[model samples]
Target: MKVSIDTDRCRGFGVCVSLCPEVFTLTDYGYSEVSVDEVPADLEGAVSEAIAACPEHAIETL
Candidate 1:
């Protein structure tokens, strides 16, 4: 699976970073960003959780 963050919809809550650090990180500007083009097998579940936990619904899978 692939993941991407819609920066326009982000509010820097850090839920994605806390739930899926392996694939997500907070930018210097405080928005969240995806660290990989494709989700690793081990991190897929965590990424999914992050997507759901995101209060702004900023994370999406492709």
Candidate 2:
């Protein structure tokens, strides 16, 4: 699975980062960003949780 973060919608809540550090991270400017090119099999569940937990609904699957 692939995921991308919508910077404009992200509020830097850090929910995604906390749920899955392997796939998501907070940028220097304090925003969520996708750290991986593709979601690993083992991390897909965590990534999905992050997507659901994100208040801004910034994470998207591709």
Candidate 3:
């Protein structure tokens, strides 16, 4: 699956980074930033958890 982050809606909570560090990182802006467009097979579960943990609902799976 592909992961997308809506920066406008992000609150820089770091939930995504905590849940899926392999797929996401905190930018200098303090919001979570995507490292890759598509998630690797091994990281899918973590990514899903990250999406669920996002309080701002900024992450979307496509």
Q: Where is model 1 more than 4 Å wrong at Cα?
A: none
lDDT of candidate 2 over 1-62, digit per residue (tens): 99998888999989999999988888899998888898989999999999899999899999
Off by over 4 Å in 3: none
Residue 55 local lDDT, model 3: 95
TM-score of every prediction relative to native: 0.95, 0.96, 0.93
Tell me which residue pairs clash in candidate 3. Answer: none
- Could you tally the backbone clashes for each prediction? 0, 0, 0
User: In candidate 3, residue 59 scores what lDDT?
Assistant: 95
Better of 1 and 3 by TM-score: 1
Per-residue lDDT of model 1, residues 6-60, tens digit only: 9889999999999988899999999899889889898888988898899999898
Q: Model 3 misses residue 8 by how many Å? A: 1.1
For each candidate in the order shown, give its overall lDDT on alpha carbons: 0.90, 0.92, 0.90
- On TM-score, the candidate that comes out on top is 2
Rank order (by TM-score, best first) = 2, 1, 3
Error of 2 at 49 (Å): 0.4
